[model samples]
Target chain A: MTRPVTSTDVARRAGVSQSAVSRAFSQGASIAPETRRKVLEAAAELNYRPNRIPAIMLSGRSRMVGVVVGGLSNPFYASTLECLATSLRAAGLQILLVHVDDALTLDSALDQLLSYRVDAVVTALAIGSQRAARMLSDLAIPVICFNSRLTGPWISTVVSNNHAAGLTAAQVFESCGVTRPAWLAGPVRNAASRARGHGFIAGVRANSARWPDGVLEMRGDDSYESGYDAIRRLLARGERPDGLFSSNDLMACGAMDALRQHGSLNCPDNVVMMGYDNIPQAGWHAYGLTSFDQQVDCLVDAATQLLDAALGPDGGPVSRTRVVDARLVTRRSTARLI
Target chain B: MTRPVTSTDVARRAGVSQSAVSRAFSQGASIAPETRRKVLEAAAELNYRPNRIPAIMLSGRSRMVGVVVGGLSNPFYASTLECLATSLRAAGLQILLVHVDDALTLDSALDQLLSYRVDAVVTALAIGSQRAARMLSDLAIPVICFNSRLTGPWISTVVSNNHAAGLTAAQVFESCGVTRPAWLAGPVRNAASRARGHGFIAGVRANSARWPDGVLEMRGDDSYESGYDAIRRLLARGERPDGLFSSNDLMACGAMDALRQHGSLNCPDNVVMMGYDNIPQAGWHAYGLTSFDQQVDCLVDAATQLLDAALGPDGGPVSRTRVVDARLVTRRSTARLI
Candidate 1:
């Protein structure tokens, strides 16, 4: 059998230096047309493809964008990927989706992205890991965080305002004449969760005197099952509040199920409820949920903007932060409350 | 603004040749430890990043897999992506997700994937165009079709037995004493839809005089609205079938809604209905849809196997087609019929 052809063989056949052969395959190279033709002919004959893994040695545009998200199962992240891909096509770029479930070890994933030499990196559902932030800063590549809590004067972030959105949910419940309210909080330690929880509590405190000292801060798991299980546990205690606020729509949907099953926990009639991240299911008549719209368009636009900045002409002194606003969409679930 | 530091500048600062600087950073290259140290230190001081994009010209392992799919609004593809990611992770690969809607040309998408030199292309919901198949064939990079049809043995494919699964549904209906059946199919000219339709008709005709002309084929979009509309249109004709088989669960759910509203379609009593793609919602009591499982593990395994062949040591001449088996999932939708 003939041995596999190598770049050296193509170089010899084309009568060009090894470096010239490499440059010929690299995008945006200034190789002469005749020389390029000769190199191409030789490569075709030998079945020699310029390997992309060693792209560090060449200079050209990869036309690949590295998209980093925290979760694939989360409907928010899933929908974000859908929108990002659409926007990317409009911009004539392709998305390389990377899921970093464990936020702390983003370095390895980043390294893989770097190896591919993608034009930029966009993160959705990023939980402000210091190591990840530092690595991204050091990489000096364009990085955009969608719905992440890395907002500052320097880093670019495209996320709905969790703080304000949470506040709006609380005000909606209060406006419905609810004297006593309970909170179904997300992970207590998560930055976005903390901000949202604080905002809601602040709103309820400002309007109502029946707010409990220890807001039923059941730590959320950001899943439908977790929401259902948590709410069931809370309802089992026999002290149900007049209103409830869930940090995410999944949990709220789960809470809806739990409320329906527990005869004592009536909703719309007795206890009004609201949630965040108005996912697709929120509009379903069965759920008829009221939640915060993370502004898919604004979020996607902000993410693309960060990517643009990351790949800007200068690629220097990147934007510190960008915050997109979230809006409250009241459906039947919260219609009575608002 | 000051000029951005280049690799040439790093070389000058490190007192080394440009090639030596390159060698120092190149993985697995024979470079002295001290030399590599000097190059790194100089690069940091000058804020220089080696032209990473050039690696696209270097080696075949871009470590990037292109995953093309359509209809993110559908939950099945969304869930498939989740599993595909895990499978790719185990192989130490990352995914580049490309979402193409109906209006766009898949060939254009393939062109984009080609330009990025993606290691392999895996399409979840679309088929590779003849032109793309030829292009990839000439390029020697495999284009693995996941849950699609393959006309020739040259291309690698991982797909479920839609035809057999359809037959399974018919058999269930027959055992349940159904004499007449109507089909709710996907869009016209879809290969998967056609296969299922043909198989269901064949199964119904076997061992029975029922359905002399086979089940009535009604075309609809693979969505809830289409399903609802198709069933409504069928019912308005003043003729009804004893059994219903929707090509997918979304449409089946919609059909159930229409039946409920019209007061003519009740599962196990008025008519027995079934769907395919066993989506999560099929289990809901509101819509207890019996369906067929696509066997996600087998589908993923087949794709992985094809990729292995394409990138294997033998350079791939033996493996091409793999068909995963589908199973009939008995649920309340068909329980009374059975």
Candidate 2:
């Protein structure tokens, strides 16, 4: 049998450099149309299908973005991941997904992604330690944290303006004549949750003179069960807040259920509820929850724009943060009671 | 500046072949521990870090699996992807995720995955056409359809026993002393939905002799709004289903909300509801929906098993289907009234 054709043979046949042949097959590679056409013609004639792995090795660009994700059960993260995948694919990149159970396994997840030599990484989970961030910077790998906060050289963050969202929630509650308010915060270590909580307290303090202290805060692990139990336990103690804001929609839904089941309270009539992340379930007829729309498409657009800049010809990995405004979607859950 | 050390340099220093050095760095490669240790020591002394892309080029194994996903807004699909990612990662395989907007974009998604030369593919969407299946077969790629049914050469499918779940739903409804039963089917092209509908109809006919005709059927595109509207439209026509089974849990929750909000009917009181894919939302206090658990972990285990066989020694591309049994989880939605 005759030897199989190679990129070298194609280059000789097409009267172009072997690198030109490789570029002709690589997506998003810079090659003149005429040269690409000639190279393709030669490849077709010679029945040579260039393998991508070898081309990636030659160019040092795998054209793949590592995406590390956790907590997909949360609709917010799931939807964010879905949008990110679509946006990245449109940019001529594929997602190398690494799913971690929690923050504990994140280091290993990063190690695995690094082993694959992905062009860059976009994660929905926080890059936990300074050591991991330094390692990524050392490798000159650009990372974009989607909806998560991370600060370091060569790192970019695209997130919803959580602080603004919290301020808006507080203003809405005050406008509804809510004297007593409560805040259901997410996990303690979550930076976004902390920012939102701070903003909410600041807004409450700025608006009210009677409240020297901040709103009642309940901590949850960002699960539906946690949200339900938090409210249930608070209500059991005979302390009821007329207005409540949850850091996440899933928790807000759980809180609503708890109020109705345990406290015999109905939303809008009894307790006005506001939540972050306007997931699809927030609009269901059962729970018309008023939520902050993170504008997932806009977040994705900003992320891709940052990625493009970082991977561009004059691209030097730089630290940047793009904060998209969160808009409020009004529904029955937060209707003005007063 | 010092020249970068290569695998060849490591091989020379370790007194081993270059291929052995490559294998030593490659995850899950066949290399003796002693040889790997020697290679690692030599590489460390030389400050050599093996780039995975070049190793993949030499080994022809990218150690990556392509996962095509769609409709992540649906909780079931989102959770399924999470499980698949975790399982694949545990097996020392990375996931290359391709997100498609719908069936129309599936072809392009597959093309992108093919360019990456993924070791295998696991899709949540159907492999729509025979041409696409043929293309994958020609490439000698092993594809496992997770919770999807596709029959072709070199294809493996791991799906829940939909028909059995349907039959069980029918029996549950019958035992609840329901005279009027209704089946809400998912999209028309969905094989799992069709099988479940068939089995439900068969069960209805087998159990009830009085009814010559099968139960009433409603079609939905497997969206929450679609389920709500289908039930609302039927209710407008004064057709009330005492017993209802939705092909998916999201739609069931929608149907339940419709029954309560529009028809002023309560589940297990005015109507009993059953759903498939025991999503986390099903157990929410608001719904408490009885559903068939597809056993996501088992399905993932089976898919990975099939993948191992296809990629193992003496492994050849073959067509195989593994149907995991779907178990019914009882809740208030289907609680017996009699």
Give a tens-digit lDDT track for model 1, residues B1-338: 44557778989999988887888767668888888899888976775666644454455466568878666566677777777777886786768787777421244565456445667777665454665555556555666776555423335777779899889888888877777788888886466777888889889878457657677779888887788889889899976877899988888888887787788568767788898878766765456688888877778888887887777675543337788888778887777743
For each candidate in turn, the interface RMSD (Å) is 4.6, 2.4
- Could you tell me which 10 consecutive residues in candidate 1 chain A have the lowest summed lDDT? A51-60
Candidate 2 collision pairs? none
Each candidate's lDDT (Cα)? Answer: 0.71, 0.82
Query: How close is every model to the real structure, measured as TM-score?
Result: 0.78, 0.90
* Model 2 alpha-carbon drift over 4 Å, by segment: A1-49, A103-108, A147-149, A210-213, B1-49, B103-108, B210-213
Candidate 2 lDDT by residue in tens digits, B1-338 = 24657889999999999999989876679999999999988976775667766546666787888888888888888888888998887888878898888731244565566455788888766666676776666556788885555557778788788988888888898789887889999987688898899889989999767445569899988888989999998899988778999999989989999898874778889899999989999999999999999988898899899999988884567888898999899999988554
Error of 1 at A101 (Å): 4.1
Model number with the top TM-score = 2
Top candidate by lDDT: 2
In Å, residue B251's CA in model 2 sits off its true spot by 0.8
Q: Would candidate 1 be rated incorrect, acceptable, medium or high by CAPRI criteria?
A: acceptable
